[model samples]
Target: MPVDQPHSSAPDILHGWGARQRGGRIRVKGGGQVSQIYAIRQAIAKGIVAFYQKYVDEQSKNEIKDILLTYDRTLLVADPRRCEPKKFGGPGARARFQKSYR
Candidate 1:
């Protein structure tokens, strides 16, 4: 379950590993740069759960399974250099263009 940085992502991955016993609620809370994206996604998922709960939806469990499956796997497997915006030919590395003075 290692993401971008092994050292930074270690604690979050460990937290998720033992969450299955607690009704599969993965609690990833911290103040780290690498964990922000994951924490945001978890918060969003919790909101979705609340929505389903109000509606008495039975498909929520399956949806949670899909989310867990996606989180558990390495969704991004591209080389770091290949991910630069310039590689896609839209603009420069920062996706910015030089101002034309014409």
Candidate 2:
């Protein structure tokens, strides 16, 4: 996948920690730079764990998980924050309709 240079570091981290041995394509849906990067990293991390599960022993799998967590807690954890819904009387999430009096 072609990611922006600023957001390219996360994947490099995974590659540095032995993930380069495994290769596969990833397709990510909608999101901005940071979100897309997070999704890609999470997918890569999960892929690594799955690969280990299939080929390596349990101890090594746990070690990989620990290493990922230590490097970035969010690598395996999904972010919980979402965009707030727009209010009924507002044009945006938090903005209220403008007051006008003649």
TM-score of each: 0.31, 0.67
- What is the clash count for each candidate, in the order shown? 0, 0
Alpha-carbon lDDT of model 1 = 0.46
Which residue pairs in candidate 2 collide? none
Q: In model 2, which range of ten residues has the least summed lDDT?
A: 3-12
Clashing pairs in 1: none
Model 2 TM-score (2 dp): 0.67
C-alpha RMSD by candidate, in order: 12.3, 3.8
Task: Report lDDT per candidate.
Answer: 0.46, 0.78
Error of 2 at 27 (Å): 1.0
> What is candidate 1's lDDT per residue for 22-57, written digit by digit as tens?
234545666565556545454545444454557656
